[model samples]
Target: MLNNSTTLVKGIGNEKAKDLEALGIYTVKDLIEYFPFRYEDYRPKEIQELKHEDRATLIGTVQSESTVRFFGKKKSKLSVRILVGNILLTAVFFNQHYLKPKLVVGETVTLTGKWDQHRLTITVSECKFGVLDSQGYDPVYSVGGNITVKGLKKMISSAMEQYGQIITEILPERFLTSYKLIERKLAIYKLHYPKSFEDAKHARRRMVYEEFLLFQLKMQALRKFHRENSGGTAIRIQKDDVELFISNLPFPLTIAQQRVVKEILRDMESPYRMNRLLQGDVGSGKTVVAAICLYAAVTASFQGALMVPTEILAEQHYHSLKGLLEPMNVTVELLTGSIKGKKRKDILARLQSGQVNVLIGTHALIQDEVVFEHLGLVITDEQHRFGVEQRRTLRNKGQNPDVLFMTATPIPRTLAISIFGDMDVSTIDEMPAGRKPIETYWAQHHMLQRVLGFVEKELKKGRQAYVICPLIEESEKLDVQNAIDVHTQLQQFFTTYQVGLMHGRLHPSEKEAVMKQFSANEVQILVSTTVVEVGVNVPNATIMVIYDAERFGLSQLHQLRGRVGRGDAQSYCILLADPKSDVGKERMKIMTETNDGFELSQRDLELRGPGDFFGSKQSGLPQFKVADMIHDFRALEVARNDAVELVTSEYFWTSPEYKSLVMFLEEEGVLAGEKMD
Candidate 1:
């Protein structure tokens, strides 16, 4: 079904097929899965029944039509007064000259849009001329690129009629029956053209479940494969060495940090190579716990490498670890892409000769030429920043090296287990002593004066502040200003203080310079993108202002808030968010109510999705077209349980029920770390 192209369907010629392919519909099965993004309730309503902001469809006869008022030659406004029974309903059209001629006196038409009760009018974005009745609950596909909505609907109808029966079901029938799931064929049919809201809801449930089930099954397969292949002779843990390193610390480890260290040590002592995830909130001292484990590996006559997402993070970790380890006679070195010429060769020689016991670097550590002498342990700091292949490549440098993955993403326990089932997870939930919870406030656009006044007050106290702008998608124009614009505006606002700007487009050296200036308090206010959301340590900064806070996920907002409250003085996190939606306001409300990273993460998963939780390129989650990790989380749990049971049962590999599923998972390439299917 997936192999056959859409060109085979009736009415879809080569030129039309090209348009369909642009919408990601290439095959017959692809056309079938191209479900509507939304279902418009075109069921006509009475004129008096329409409330403010009600997206209503009104069916009535055109009683009168105004002369076309031209704003431009192609752009004109027409006000049509439609009579529904005795009441007159207004329909306004903008730039639709073709519709003006069609709206003659005493002609029936259906129009749908948000109704303005005060004005008693509705904008006619979508309208259909009819003689009889209105179409109820119409499918609304995202149509563009020369294919009209009617044309796309006709193509879908043709494809379904010709090839719907041949569409193979990937889920096993036995498993579906056990779970009481809706049938695959029925779900697909109802998803595209459901008669009622309940039917659409059930169809969406089934499809979302199928998406999660396939992902979990592949992850389970990958987990099995990794355990089989990544196992090696374990390096014995040197307790005395770990203790000496821990004792050298200026501060004591929190109970959470100590517990996580023990878990890592235990995993490394096992015969199987350690594949563990170190999770903690910001300022949770997870790095120190990782340090202890790396020290243990070094003491056991094995070289260790720790790679971070950014050079700033790498430099921070290097200076931090070097200050602690070099005093103990452990040779620690930093290797990055910037290290070149004689300096790069010297570092490489030192690594090969085991002169550097603990090597910490950025992306350069994973390069093929940077070979190690006895690379027994590999650590990836901020694991999600690096892709799947990168982690595997770094691990392959050693003969089945022990892998320790670290993240400050503060994932909920259930989500962590569901997504990273391939690795054992250890979380540090407690923060170090002397840290304070950031004082959070939610404000609107009108409160800009008061919020900036607060920032000025803080700056006057000789402290610094961070201003972060929401990540704007290139395709979507953000209503609020961007980082550079905000920086420019704030410069004039805070003329007495120095302000700096940082964004993704800045060069590496330029970014380092800006960050260095900010850290040194030379720049009293630093305006940056989400790049400063993690691993940026400036204890002097006591204020964080996020513009358009509703545009970001709760987890990211929480991380940004964490930038402050690291110092002794009280810090403030002011959110300048004025969302046009109630849902967006609700997200901001959640941020004001909690400071717990775990709670925020769980709420974030519920409010949106894991895909939207971070940038698409950095989320580290498999791309599932239907499954939203936020709303369809129950499906993830169900899939995880079912996958566990299926692998334990005899039907995992040999049964006909699993054939199409296995093939589909293999085709999706969901698991890239040492390929499972």
Candidate 2:
């Protein structure tokens, strides 16, 4: 049945196939499964339902011949008056000269489209050669170049009608019954064209459940596979060394940090490969905890690899770890994309010989040539930036290195399990002592002078200011202003203070130079994009000014704000918003009300939903339909508990019902990272 299916056949010329390949579509199966984002309820409306104020769909017939109006373009717009009983509604079709002939005079037609009451017009869609009858929903695909809703609907209907039967039932019958799952083929069929709302609802529910369950099964399978196959290299560390490392720190470790450290130690001692995730809020002393683990690896006489996302972060970690471990006689080397020539060769050699006890770096560390002499600990800071595959490469650097994944982004508990099922979890929920809350404000354009005045005052007081812009380049589509323009403008505006620019487009050296100058108090006003949102900790910088603050996500804004308030001085974050739109008001409110990144993230999750939760380039978790990481948190928790209970029970991997699920996970293992498909 699958072999004879339409989904198995290609439907394009060679040239068209190449074009489709650009969009990552190769086969008929890809096209058929490319489901619509939403279903538009464009079911034909009754004539009696029509009102002057409300926008309604109205069926009509052309009372007279349609006319075409041609401007500068070759194609003409069809201008026709649609008749709904005695009432005549004016309708216009743009770039559709062919539609004029289709709307025959004195012929009845059904128009299922939006009505403009103010303009007194009806936009026709699905204009069948008949009067209005029963209503039904229609599928609407996400807009692409030249892809019309009508065309998509027709293609989808054709695909389903011809190949729907061939879509194999992967889930076992007993499993379906246990989960109360609807039939796969029936759900897909009804989803595209449901006879009733109840049918649509059922189909939607079934699809959502399937999406969640399949994803869950995949993660569980991977977890089991890794545990069974991979043998971990456990590093035995003396308690005295870890305690001494902790005691030497300038500040005391928070309870959360201590708890996470204990968890790491526990994992290090375990026989199984330790895949643990250490999640904490910004400035939650995660670095100290990581440093302690590194100390443990050094004490155990094994090399450690600390992988970061960016070169700047690598440098920062290098300096930070060097400062902490230099006293303990543990050598730390930094390796990144920026490290080239003799210096790079030296670092690589040192790493290879195990002369460098702890190696901190970016992607450069994961290169095949770089060898580790008994590398027992693999710590990946900011796991969101490095996907599971990326981390796996780093892990494979040593034979089953105990992986410790760290992230500043504190996700909700339930989401953590779904995202990191292959890894054990540890969370640092506390901030170290003397950490002051940044004073946040939602400054409108009208208060720009006030914000500038505050920056000027801070600058005069020998403190630096960070002026953050949303974008690097001006985009006509987006309302957010650019950092380059802001930098140029600020240089002129604040002639007394030195202004520096840093963004993604800048060379790594140039960025480093600017950041160095900013840190040294040479650049009083550092106008930057979100590039410095994470790295470069300058306590001297007390003021943060963000332009078009509404354009940034809540967590991002929080991260940006985190750049300031690192010192003893009272820091302030002025959020510049456009007064015309209430766009950034919620973000501003959240920023002002709390200094807690977790709370702000929760609020952000509530407002923005889970689609862009971990940013566009999705990381750890599989794409979930009904399981919202924030809103549907309860459902996620239930799923997690159910999964855990099942995994712990005799029925986990041994059960017959879970066989297909394990296979699915093994198949999709490469893609499931963090909310990534």
Candidate 3:
């Protein structure tokens, strides 16, 4: 089996493996069992079911010879008339002059596609000629780069042909019998080339169970490790101190905010280390919950650190924390890559001397020079932006400071459980009273003038607007409008409006200046990329115009829409999309129909799948081989139960099979030999 694993019959080289690895396939184990994401059935249909306008797969014998017709300077198109008993249909292939010789007249062929008014368009996708008709489901392998549907099908067939019986059964026999799961050998065979729809269904079920079970087992192990090894940082919370801080707040706390603060306080009272995730929508008062935690730490004579994703977010957190905590004489210090000179030195000195009660910054907060004084609480805003190592680095700054990670991106409950398996999650679902949902619209390019007029009207009313483009500059691959070009165009067209440009390429200070000007209403219209997605909140801003809305994922469009509707007045989120494609129309429809982030996220997962939604850059969620995040949710739940049971059982660590699994996990960076410090 080991020998069979390394050698491919067609002989795959390092170059091919490297390309596969780029798509997250690293080992033979990953490739052989890589199941198809979806399937399309290509069974021949009866002539009675065939509509004039509908695309259908039909089986018939050609009655005459094929002929090619060419226009001047254009490649010829091949056309053939076929007869199936009483029905006659024309099969057409475009720009394929060479097909005339291969597909001779009077040959029986199976073709699939829609029939136009007169011509039946040939779909070159996996059609078989002179073969027995198939009447069931067909698998569609998720192909990428150089791997085409035809090529992948061939490779998979070859792999199965060579290593038919050599495949090892990884799961223990006893467990397999107990779960009623099929053998790994049978599962692999049917996954790639199933004999029937029932076989494929069973194969998918077994594979999904295996992936979910393994993933849940890993999380359960981590949870158990934390439960046993995590030494709770017990802080004596002065209820008076907490109440005093809350009382001094300029605005009253929302019920959700109050609930989260209470939960954090309870966690701080525990002797176990606090590993909590705070998830909230935009403007849901997460910053305030964080400040309450900081106050608790300070009142206990300990320090807390807040780390944000970007310098701008760090700055925003700093000011917000300062405004709330400074009144109580708690010193809030700001740190980032941008801070330098004497000011930086002074902040570090104060931090080391325990003068700074709370420090807020970007990744610079993880640097060796940034030492904390009695750091007891570590809070990371937008925790997904930081790597596991980076977050651990900051946490290790103190003796295993209680870690709290926050996210503005709202995820569904099932996703939260699977993704953040190790951390206790707290959600702030309710927005504060007086906040309004951003009225959203989906429009075409032709309506740009009307959208512009609306923006002008808002500006005339002393409000501000944000124009978001997906790209920073022009791209040959993507012809969408960009920030730089849009800025210039707006400046030329809306000559009276103060338009400012900001993107990722700008210097930190430059971006900050542009944001400040926009916040101060110096710039009535801010043209930027998603850089504005996280910062520069202005109550006066009532409009958010996102160009190329189809270019963005639903979650992203939701986040950009969150920029507006933060204030009291009615706000609008205008999504401008080129609605030519079905996907484009569906994406825009989701934006206009729903304001609930959770619903949108689920829809996004269903439409775009988990890969593009979590994205390559941030694959924080465990990649499952067979578990569909949207469809196989029940399997996920079952896996969750099994994981919890295994972890709680005494034999989990003692069992040899689990030991091997643990070692595998450790090597994958999902688990370490010991608990995280």
Candidate 4:
């Protein structure tokens, strides 16, 4: 019955059903579960007790006859003087001329609107005849597509009334009893028609918990399935050989790096497949750790593959890894979209023949033509840049290979668990030895002359600088500095120095050429967009000037700042911005105070929210209707723990207590067609 079409609800026909479907409500269950975004409190209050600008309900008797006056075009204003207690208040309604006939001089009426204390006026949004007998709250739905809020509310109420009783509880009985949660049916009813704010709060809590628990249960099930079904080849590498390789490296591993490497190696050696995330700040030596793991797999007579988002990043990894591993007799090859003809064929043939011990490339690595003989370890750099399916495809190329995902973007712990719950997380918290923290400063556009003077000093010292603008071209709507204009300005100002321009609009080869010039000190100043935010590494660059820095998120500012501090020289990041909004100002302030990407990421989540934190692609974070991952993180933690416990139980799938949950998971397609054994 709950699965019946929404047309089954009263007052809903084919057209109405289409409107509801536009809102993602196709079935009766979806209709009832479409919870109100907010509620309007219609509880009457005295004018004296209500604050100015408060949305309040007032009960009063009409002291004056309602007057209607026509205004601009079809607009009309209706006003009436209502007397409550000893006070006379004016009630004004816009475009509600029909109320004039209903407002009798002595009749009592209810008015709800914004209250103006100084004027003793109620800008009435809703006016009704007679006072309410008791307090009431109206649920407000976010409606669209020819469906009014009133219509959605009516449809949802009808659906709940008809099918609420049959909405089975998916949670186990023990959980409900232990958590002291109300029944699912009551919760659904209260969510749509809450008698009080407390009732609404409790109902929302129940729904949030249920949503999180179900999601975590799915994660737990996926983790368990991967561990059991995706058998991993235990890479038999001697500890002495691993130690010898680490000791031979030019740089010693930091304590944090050592710990993370140990965790990754353990996963590789275990019988279960490795599903891990390596999170480190920019220039934190994550690539070195990945190199060690790749070496381990290669030494164990298995091929290794590394995939990145961009061609330049792939080539950069290829050159660095070749330098590091080639001496160890590890045959390394690069496969990118640019590699063509005989070169590409030779690499593919070598990969298939098990001669290419390690292959590095962009999306070309996932192409059907590329095959590996004994692909054992798969590592993806900047994992968030690739879509979920893209990453999965690369992993599928190899048979249950140990997979490690590396990202320089530090995710908050709360988000990591929610988004990457199935994968083991290892964070490199320490920067490499002798690396200097970049000094960050915020400035307004008026201080550009002084900032440029400072940049000139750095250039005079034979150091390079990066000038970043938010836009590639002039935006007619936004009055901000653009890369083209900035590049032209810098070129004119610093005529003696070579200033190379780069933006997303540039071809990949063109961008790579510009980057190479900057890296080789041929370009003393690089004026580019945020394309330099990720993989461009120039240790000689000591100054970073970002115009309209407030337009960028905190995490992005951090990434751009990271490009400079890679060298031993003291680096500085200058933010030229005069933000009009408080959030923008706060972001600039936060960037200047710390270089901790994780800390900045948390603040970014709080300021810009999860949707904008990762720049539109939420990186696979589940969307919850009522549950806010940031605010309701405690609930998420609780749900995750509960899910782990329940999934680990021997009778989770077969027991009668969990039958409803199992059925719900299957019905919702969360189980992915996995059956009970």
Best by TM-score: 4
- Deviation in angstroms for 385 in model 1? 5.0
lDDT of 3 at 247: 91
> Which has the higher lDDT value, candidate number 3 or candidate number 4?
4
- Top model by lDDT, which number? 4
Each prediction's whole-model lDDT (CA): 0.83, 0.75, 0.81, 0.89
RMSD of 4: 3.3
Per-residue lDDT tens digits for candidate 4, residues 175-264, read 888888888988988988889999999899989999999888888887887787787878887678778889999999999999998999
C-alpha lDDT of candidate 1 relative to the true structure? 0.83
- Model 4: clashing residue pairs? none
TM-score ranking of the models: 4, 3, 1, 2
Whole-model lDDT for model 3 versus the true structure? 0.81
> Candidate 3 — which pairs collide?
55-113, 55-114, 232-271, 232-272
The whole-model C-alpha lDDT of candidate 2 against the native structure comes to: 0.75
Model 3 backbone overlap count: 4
* Per-residue lDDT over 429-516 for candidate 3, one digit per residue giving the tens place of the 0 to 100 score: 8888777888899888899999998888988888899999999989999889888999998898889889999999998789888888
The predicted structure with the larger lDDT, 2 or 3, is 3
Per-residue CA lDDT of model 2 for 13-104, tens digit only, reads 56544544554456655556656566666566665676664445566778878888898858666778877877777877667677777788
Give the residue spans of candidate 3 off by over 4 A: 2-44, 49-181, 226-232, 239-255, 309-312, 327-329, 335-350, 362-369, 386-390, 412-419, 471-479, 488-497, 619-623, 655-677
Candidate 2 ranges beyond 4 A from true positions: 3-36, 42-132, 141-169, 172-179, 239-252, 307-373, 383-397, 409-421, 470-496, 503-507, 579-594, 599-677
lDDT at position 393, candidate 2: 85
Error of 3 at 561 (Å): 2.6
